[model samples]
Target chain A: MMIEESFVNGNSLIHRLNPVLKIGFAIIYSFVVAVSSKFPSLFAALFIALFLVILARLNPRKAAVRLAAVNGIIILFWFFLPFTFQGEALFHIGPFAVTRPGVIFAAGITLKANAILIAFIALVATMRVTTLGHALNSMLIPEKLVQFFLLTYRYLFVIQTEYQKLTRAVKVRGFRPGTNLHTYRTYAYLAGMLFVRASVRGERVYQAMLCRGFKGKFYSLHEYSISKADITCAVFMTAAIVILVVLEWTKII
Target chain B: MDKDNLIINLTDISFSYPEGAPLLNNLSMQFYKGDRVGLIGPNGGGKTTLFHIIMGLLKPYSGKIEIFGKPVREEKDFRSVRQRIGLLFQDSDDQLFSPTVLEDVAFGPLNLGKSVDEAKVIARKNLDSLGLSGFEDRITYKLSGGEKRMVSLATVLAMEPEILLLDEPSAGLDENTRASLIKVLTGLDLSYILISHEMEFLDSTTTSVYIMKDGKVFMNGDRQIHRHYHIHPHSALPHRHESGFGKKYTDFLA
Candidate 1:
C-alpha cells in the first residue's frame, strides 16, 4: 500500500515523468539552495519549490503539517544553540542571552534546513520509494547500496508489525511491567526473542531470494528515457539557480 | 504415472528441528511431468517443510531428493534445479519483497538472466493473464490479500518454470478469489503441487491427492477415493456428512 499511495496517481504529468529526472532535479535544486548563503537567493529557490509543490497539486495543509513537524525539531536546535554558545550579548536573561551573530547563524541554519526539508518532502512524498531505488540504480549507484535501501524500506513496516504483534502477544499472556527484577528479565527475554525472530526471518528471506534465482543483484525495468520536457525542466531550473547565484554575488536581486 | 518422466523423487525423507522435535519422518513420494497433485494435511503436519525440501530450500536429515533425475545436495545443484521449478509461499508478503508489483513479477525472470525488455514482456503478460494489467505500478504491500496472491503467482509464472509448488494457495482467500484461483490452477498446463487443507478446492483442481500426517505421507489416492469418502467437491472441510478430512483421515489411519 505504501507503493500504491506513493506512486500510481491517476493522470498526473508529474507522475508520468521519469523518476530519475525528478530525483536529479530535486537534488540539484536542493544543493544549489543549500550552498547559497544569501537570503534572497534561498528565498527565491524556496518560491520555485513552492510553485512546483502547487503544480504537483498535493494537499497544502498536509504538506504544511509535515513541514511544521520537521522544522519544529530544527527550531529546538536553533533555540538551544544561542544559549549554549559564548558571544557578545544583545540581551541578557536569567541564565541565557541572545546575540546578534547567534541570531544570524541560527537564521542561516534555519534557511538551509527548511530548504532541504521542503525539497526532499516535495520529491519523496510524491514519488514511490521503489521508483527512487530504480532511478538511483540506473544512475549507477552500487547494487548493494540500492538493495540495502530497498530491503530496509521494505522490512521497516514488517519489523514494526512484528513489534506490534509481540506487544499484543505479551499483553495477552498477562505480562506486566512492574518495578521488579522479574519484569525486567521478562522484557529482556522478549527483546531477545524479537531479535531472533527477525534474524530467522531474514535468513528465510535470503533463501527466498536465492530460490528466485537471485545472483547478487537486483534488477528493474525502467525504459522511460529523459524526454525533451525533462531536459527542459532540468535546464530551466539550473538557469534559475545560476541567475540567483549571480544576482546574490552582485547584490542586485 | 510415467516412471520415465519422474520430475521429483523423494525417498525416505526425514527432518527434525535442531531441538530434536520431529517434523517430517521417512517421507517418500514421486511426482511426474504434467501432474496436478494436492498435498493436504492438518496444521503442523510439515506440509510446508516438504515443499521446501522439494524446492531444495531446506535439507532433509535423511533420504535423497532427485530433481530431473539429478541428486540435490548443495546450493549449487539447487541453483540449476530451482530455475526449472517455481515455489509460491503461503504468505505473499514473504514471497514479494520488491517495491512495485511489476518489479516483483519480473524478479524471477530477470534473475534468470532475461533481458530487461524480455522480462518486462513476460511479467506484463503474466499480470495481464491474471486480470491485473493496470496494477503493475501498484505497491506490493498495499494490495489486497487476493491481489497479492495473484501477483505472487505472476512472479513465479513469469519465470516459466515447468513445475510450480504452491503452499496454501487458497488460505485467507475469499470465495470469489478461491474460485478465480481454481480457474487459474485448472488452466495451468505446467506440473504443480498445491498444499492446502481446503478439500473442496483440492478435490476440484487436483488430479491426485497426498495427505501428510506427522510429517509423512498418510494417504495417496485419486478423485474416486475422494468421492467414495463422501468429500464434497464444492464445500469447505468438516462437512456435516463427515467429521472432517483431518479427523476422518486420521481415524482411518488409526
Candidate 2:
C-alpha cells in the first residue's frame, strides 16, 4: 500500500510521451545540465526542467514537496561549502573565512541538481516503473538487468510485508526497544530472518516462474506505439537538449 | 484404472533436504484423468514437497516419475510437463511476479509461445471466468488477499493446463470467499490435486481425499473418509474424529 507512484496517474502531454524517448531525453538533458558551469546555462536548464514539469501537469503542492526534499539535501552543501572551499574570502564566520567562490560553487550545484532531478521527475517518473523496465528493454538495456529491476520492484512490497509481520510478532510478545545488547541482538536476528525468508521466497518465486513455462526470455505484455503527439514531443525535447548544449558551449545564452 | 489414464505417477519417490531429516520416504501416488483429489496433512508432512516433485520443481533423489504416461526424466522433460500442467504456489506473492494482474496472467500464456495478443485474450478470458473481469489493469500487489488468490488462479488457468496442482488455494480466505472458491473449483472441468487443510472445503471441492503423513499417503479414501467434513455449527461442542489415519484428529469447535 505504501508504493506511491504519485506522478504517474495523469493525462498530461509529458505523461503521454513515449517512455523510451522520455528516458533517453532525460539522460541527455541531465548530462548537458551537469557539465554546464555558467549561471546562464544552468538557469536556462532549470527553466526547461520546470517547463517540462509544468507540461506534466503535476499537482503543484506535490511538486513543491518533491523540490523541497531535493533542496533539503542541498542545504547540507550550503552549510559547508561557503566556509570550506579555498576561494576569494568574502566574510568571516567565527574566524573561518566564507569564500565568495565557494558560495557560487554551491549555488551552481544547487541549480544543476535541481535541474536534472526535476527533468527526471517530469519525464521519467511520470511512467510506471514496470513501464520503465519495458522501455529500458526496448532501448537495448540488457534483458537480464531489466528482469532484475522489475522483479526487485515487484518483490519489494512482499519483503516489506514480511518485515512488518516480524516486527508485529515481536511487538506483541512485549519486546520493547532500548539501547541495550538485547535490543541489538534482537534487531540483528529480525534482520537476518528477513533476509532468510526473502531468499526462500525468492526460490519459490523462481519455481513458480518455472511452473509457468518461463524460459530465460521475458515477454512484455505492453506494446508502446509512437503517436503524433509523442513524435512532436520527441522532436521538441531533442531540440531543447541541443539548445542547452549549444548555450553551454557558445556565447549565445 | 488403466495405466493409459494415469495423469501423474510417482513410485517409491524419496526426497530429503541436504543434511536435513527425511522429508518424503518411499512415497507413491497416482492421479488419473478427471480425478479431483484433495491432499491433506499437518505442517512439514511433505505435502508441498510431493506437489513440487509432481511439478518437477523438486526432483526426488530416488524415484520414478511419469506424467500423462510419459516417463519424465532430465530437466528438458519438465518443460512439456509445465506446459501441460500448471502449479499454483501456496503463496500468491510467489505465483504473481508481474506488476499487474493482466500481465501476470498473460505471463504463462506468453511463455507457452502464444502471441502477445493471443495471450492477453486468454488472460482476459480467464480473469473474466474468475469474476475478475475489470481487474486487468489493477496492480497485483495492491489486491486484497482473496483477490490476489483469484488472480493467481487466473494466472495458472490462463495456461489452459490439463491438470492443476493447487497448494492451499483456500488457506487465508474468509468464509464467503472460501465458499466462492469452492464453487469455482467444483465448477471447473479440468482435473486438479487440491491441497487444503479445511475438511469442509476439500469435501465440497474434491471427490476423494488422500491424507499424507510420515512422508507417504497414510490414508486414501472417498471424500466421505473424514466425518469432520461437515461444518460444525458455532454452538456445537468440541469433538474428536477417527480419520482412519490411526490418529484422532481433534476439532476444538465450541
Candidate 3:
C-alpha cells in the first residue's frame, strides 16, 4: 500500500492539542534528537517517541514499515563512512577497516531519524488536512502558502484519478511498459494529453468557484479557538523537550 | 421586496466574445414566481451564456437584468443574491469540486454564512432527501456518474435557494437515474429555469418553454413565432400543440 498521511483517531492528549502547537512540538522534538549525540539521551528520546506512538494509538506494524523504508536508505551511507573515516579501527571487512567514530555517528543518525519520524507520526498526522491548513493560517502563515497547501491536497486525488483513467485506456489497447520506442512514445503522448485536459478542467473549476461566491481567501464555517486543554498540552510538551535537551547537554542523563 | 412580482426580467441583453460575432443579440425575457421555464437551443446557441449573464459571471455591453425587483449591473452586485439563486453547472465535475461528498454539499450553506454544524445538518438533510445516506466521507473521484450528478444536485438543494438554474442536468444520466431525477425535479416547490437539449426532460419539468436562437428569445405571446425559429433566427411558439393551449403547433412551424 502507498504511504499516505493516514490519520488515526484517538482521545490521547497528543490528539487534542492544537495543530499549530503540535507542529511546534514536532520541530522541537526533531531539533533535540538531532543535536544530541549521547547514546543514553538518544535512547531516552527514542523510548519517549515510542510511548507517544502507543499513546496516539497508531498501528505498530504500519509505523514499522515506514521506519524500515527510511532506515533502509540511511544504512547505505554507513558502509562508506566506516571505511573512509580516519579513527581508531574497530573491525576489518576484507580491505576496509571499520572505525569507532563512524560507528557511533551512524548509530546517532539512525536514532535521530527514528525519533523524528515517530514524533511526526504521533503529533502531526493525527489531525485532518483541512483543520491543519486552518491552524497554519491562524498561526500567521501567508494566505497564499496555506491556499497552495490546500489546493494541492484537494486536487491530488483528482490528478491521480485522471492519470489512472489514461493508464487504463492504454492498457485496454494492449500497451505495456517496455524499453521500446513505441511504448515510450505512447507514454509521452498520454502524459501530454492528460496535462492539456487538466488545464481545461482547472479553468472550469475556477469559474464554478466564482459562481459560488468565492473570494481570494478561503472561508470555513468552523472557527477553531485554542482550548485551555490544548494550551496545557502544548506547554507541557515544549517543557519536556527543553528539559531533555538541557539534561543531555549537562551530561546528567 | 418583489413589488413587480417578477423573479427575473432581462431587457434587451446583448453580449459577445471579442473574437466572435454576437453570442447574445438583443435577448429579452421575463419570468415570474412559480414559473418553471424551459430554455432550449442548439449547440453554442447562447443558452449557457445567458445563465452566466444573469449570474453576473459575464457582463453584457448594454443590457439590464432585474432579479427579484432589484437591478443587477455588476459582478459584485450578484454576490448577496447569488446564494439565494443556485446555478448548477453543465458539468458535475465542475460543481462537485470538494474532496468529500459531505464537504461539497456543505459548501453552499457555508458560503452563505451558516455555522459549520448547521451546514452539515442541511447537507445531511438534502442528501437524505435524495436517498443518499452514509456517503458523507466518500471521495468525489470514486463516485459513479449518476451518483456524482445526484450529489451535485444535493449540493445545490442544500442551499435552499429561491430559484435554480440547471444546465443539461439529464445529459449523462441513465434511464433509471433520469427517471428519478425527473421525479425529484417535478416535486420541487421552487421556481427554476432548466436549459437542456433533451426536449422530453424539459417538457416533463417545465410549465412553459422558450426556444432560443441567435441570442434572442423566440417564444412569445403572438402567432408570429415562425418568423424566428423557422424563417428568421429562433423565432418561437410556446407549446404549439393540442395539450398546449389546445392549438396544433404544426401550423406555427414554417
Clashes of each: 2, 0, 5
The DockQ-based CAPRI class assigned to model 2 is high
| Cα lDDT tens digits for candidate 2, B1-254 | 78778889889999998998889999898899999988877788888888888888888999899898888987799999998898888889999899889999999989989999999999999998988899999988899999999999999999899999999999999988898788888899899998887777877888887778778874346335444335556767766655443353322110
lDDT of 3 by residue, A49-148 (tens): 8887887888788888878989998898787777887899998999889998888888888888989898888887888776677778777788789877
Inter-residue clash pairs, candidate 2: none
Q: Which stretches of candidate 2 lie over 4 Å from their true place?
A: B218-223, B226-254
Model 1 docking tier (incorrect/acceptable/medium/high): medium
List candidate 1 segments past 4 Å from native: A1-18, A32-38, A84-88, A94-96, A171-193, A244-253, B218-248
Per-residue CA lDDT of candidate 2, range A171-224, in tens? 999999999999999999999999999999999999999999989888988778
State the DockQ of every prediction.
0.67, 0.88, 0.34
The candidate with the higher TM-score, 1 or 2, is 2
What fraction of the native interface does candidate 2 get right in terms of contacts?
0.93
Which is superior by DockQ, 1 or 3? 1
Interface RMSD of 3: 2.3
Worst 10 residues of 3 chain A by lDDT: A1-10
Q: Write the per-residue lDDT of candidate 1 for residues A27-122, one digit (tens) a residue.
A: 877777767787777777777777777667777787787689878887887777776666788787786797767776777778777777766666
For DockQ, the strongest prediction is 2
Q: Lowest summed-lDDT stretch of 10 residues in model 2 chain A? A: A244-253
